[model samples]
Target: MKELSKRTAGFTDSVIRRMTRISNKYGAVNLSQGFPDFDPPKEILSRLAEVTKEDFHQYSITWGAQNFREALAAKQSHFMGRKIDPDSEIVVTCGSTEAMMAAMMSVTNPGDKVIVFSPFYENYGADTILSGAEPIYVPLIPPEFSFDTDALEAAFRQNPKAIILCNPSNPCGKVFTYDELKIIADLAEKYDTFVITDEVYEHIVYEPFKHVYFAGLPNMWERTISCSSLSKTYSVTGWRLGYVIAPPVIIDTVKKVHDFLTVGAAAPLQEAAVTGLNFGDDYYANLQKKYSEKRKLFLDGLDTLDIPHTVPQGAYYILLDISEFGYDSDLEFCEVLARDVGVGAVPGSSFFKEPENRYVRVHFAKKNETLNEALNRLADMRKKIAVKK
Candidate 1:
């Protein structure tokens, strides 16, 4: 028999999903994957119910349903401070997962290089590999999760075809400040590269920090491939609806790729999500408030246990430093934590380009009681580790 593709053999299972299985095996409170344990908004749910009987079962336009794209374009344009032609510049996808892949395949050729920040969303690495592009990783130094501009510029000097940016980043929750973004934008412009962004957490930011749309910057809209999902914002991850917004040229290419990929997202789901896209500002404000409360509840628990962590500025994750535990392998540490302490987390090494066993990523997208239970279990972790020491 012929051997499998080398690419397929080289990849391993996702750490986040693996931890989820471990959590299930141990009856642990699963915080490994970044999905909300709570329900989506009532309005979204109602809309879905209404669409169930509607005639949206058939495939809509290969790009997107007309009403859905129009609503999304208007909403996104209002926030992004740019005009968007839905027909010319949007391609609804299965999810941001598909959006990323489509964007990568659209712009990149085999053996091309792309810059990925270390400690990035795990999917970016796989996206690069699947696109047949080599990734050049630059570390986002720990605790602050900030990049060194010099290092970034050096990577850009390598003339990567693109850079994947995840603002309000997952697993660390650091929102890229405007100043930080400017440095990257400058580098992208100087290097003549595309910027593919994963902005699923655009509305989940904490107070005092704002989510910046990369395409909104000067000369960036042309070079920026904005990939985002309605999943995180509307808490309808199962719906698997996302889109890419870019200049006509890139969007045209991505639309062709997306059409061949999934032939557009589920029609009913896209139609239902239009309700969410047309929602008022109050809906977003309330979402921020809800996530902020969840963040505080979870972070306060971590503080009380004296676990060192990076306070998240946005998104639903916190990276906890566990170097003092003396374990050189984050996978082992996470397994022990799940089986012994009844909680699950992602090993930090999975997200980094360099060897790192001193951190673990925890998600705070749970109900108050669930988070309290996880915290209660974690309070005893120090005692158990101390005994081992």
Candidate 2:
């Protein structure tokens, strides 16, 4: 038989998902994946129940359901500081996963180059490969997770087709400030590059740190493809409701790609999530408050245990420094940690283009009880997880 697609031949199962499985096998507290352990908003859930009895079972429009798109546009426009036309600027996808894939497919041709910041979410690498694009990884310097303007400009000099920007970045949790974003905007304008953003954690930002929409930048709307989802915001990862927001010409192409990708996001789920999109500012304020509490509770526990970790400015993830544990491979250390320390984490190596092994990514998007349980188990970290012999 012919070999499988070479594009995927080197692919391994997702490190994050693999760590979740290890957590399960050992009954460890699973903080490896970024999903919330708590329930989604009751309002959305209630609407979902009612929708089951309604006529939303059949597929909605291929681009998106009309009401869902309108709701999303209104909600996003209020925050993005632009009036988004739902009809011309949206393509509903199977979550940010498909939104990103569709965006890449729409903008890039084979052998095109895309700028990706290193220590990014692992999926960006796969997305570029699958889209037949080469990735130019610019490192997001650790400890501060800031980028050098010179390095970024050099990447842009490569005449890349696009850049993948994760605002409240995963693994490192760096929120791109307005100044940083402006630098990116300048480079993108200078090089005529598209910016594909993953802004899933937009609403989960902490105090003093704000999420600025990339598309809101001066003259950026035409060159920006904003990909986001209700997964992180509404705690509905399984619902798979995400969208690409861009100018009509770009979105026209994305709609065609999306139509051929997953048909459309689940119709009933889209209808139900509309309730969440219509939620008031107070709902978002309360959501930020809840995540702030979780971040404090979890990070304070790490401090109490004397574990060195990066304090996230926006997202729910914290990168725990494990260098003192004397592990050469972060992956093996994560496996041993799940087996012995009763906690699960994604090896930091998976998210970096560099050979980094000093940290592991863990999330705090859980119920208070679950976070407490994980903390309790983590208290015995040194006693259980030992250095390599």
The most accurate candidate by lDDT is: 2
For model 2, how does the per-residue alpha-carbon lDDT over 1-389 read when each residue is reduced to its tens digit?
A: 97889999768999999999999999999999999988999999999999999999998999999999999999999999999999999899999999999999999999999999999999999999999999999999978899999999999999999999998999788999999999999999999999999999999899899999999999999999999999999999998889999999999999999988888889999999999999999999999999999999999999999999998998899999999989989999999999998999999999999989999999999999999999999999999988665
* Candidate 1 Cα misplacement greater than 4 A, ranges: 385-389
lDDT of 1 at 84: 94
Off by over 4 Å in 2: none
lDDT of 1: 0.91
Question: What would the per-residue lDDT of candidate 1 be over residues 1-389, giving only the tens digit for each residue?
Answer: 98878876668999889999999999999989888888987887899899999889998999999999999999998889988999999998999999999999999999999999988999999999999999999999867889999999999999999999998898788899999999999999999999999999999999899999999988899999999999999988888999999989998899889988988799988888888899989999999999899989988889989999999999999888998888877898888998889899999988888888788999988889999999999998876654235
Check candidate 2 and list the clashing pairs: none
